[model samples]
Target: MFRFLPLPEGALCLIAATAFCAEYLLFYFHSTSHKGLEGYYHLILVLLIGLCVVSSVAGALLPTSFPVDLTNGIAITLQGLWFYQTAFSLYGPMMPDGCQLTGDQIACGSAASRVRGELLANFQLFSLVLGVLVAVVVSYGYAASRHGRS
Candidate 1:
């Protein structure tokens, strides 16, 4: 990308996807610094970041596919929302009773409690996904109705 000149087609998309690569690596290596519930939540976030990477690449390859573009947007939205949820759970009162935020790390009373917290995080993720799906469908339907199109 010399002087950002004569960039190849989809170069911007690939560049955007590279940012997700960095995020994925950060979360993967973050296990050393983050523990227990915090690490688990970050792991889930990494999965979402991976999705974003895949969708962005797909968008680059299939530039005309509106669905792929929509998917990339949705994945990015989910990643951002998950970040907020992780912060709230790890740094706020939403944290499971057994876990405590100790000096920038989350420590659990026991392994069993940490597992329970992970399970709760799974539930939260599923709920967020379902809610977003519902919202998307409703928005699409409303737009279609108003425009008299499907």
Candidate 2:
């Protein structure tokens, strides 16, 4: 109902990117200590978000005749990435062949397990944020397109 924004695409992308930034800043940072690595990660993430916002705005500004197939493709790609990430986290350090803790290495292994758990939890949290952002963006885009028509 509030589809007055000129660049709904940019708005949606901004929302999603903001969620991603929050997740990476809050949860993922706890899993590592390498300042250099963190810097690199943040750099990559910022660039990615920047790209998304730019593309979204460009898409919105272009002629409506522009094909939406690319948007659909991106949505599909993100779904696949999210699924892959979720599957990877499901196999956290467990047993059989996971993070097998030997006798003397129990302490160190336990520590590793704790770290792994934190990582997985962060992953899940980020995944949730991403999912919500996607939903909001898609919904906003749909509403904006419909409103644009009338």
TM-score of 2: 0.32
TM-score of each: 0.88, 0.32
Number of the top TM-score candidate: 1
Error of 1 at 34 (Å): 2.4
The TM-score that candidate 1 achieves is 0.88
Best by lDDT: 1
lDDT of 1 by residue, 52-128 (tens): 99998988898778798889988998999999999889888799879888886789999999999999999999999
Candidate 2, residues 1-95, lDDT tens digits: the string is: 44564654445544554655565455345435322222333333443444444445444455252444355335434534544443444333332
Give the Å shift of residue 108 in candidate 2. 10
Off by over 4 Å in 1: 1-9, 148-150
* Candidate 2: regions farther than 4 A off: 3-9, 33-98, 101-150
lDDT of 1 at 110: 96
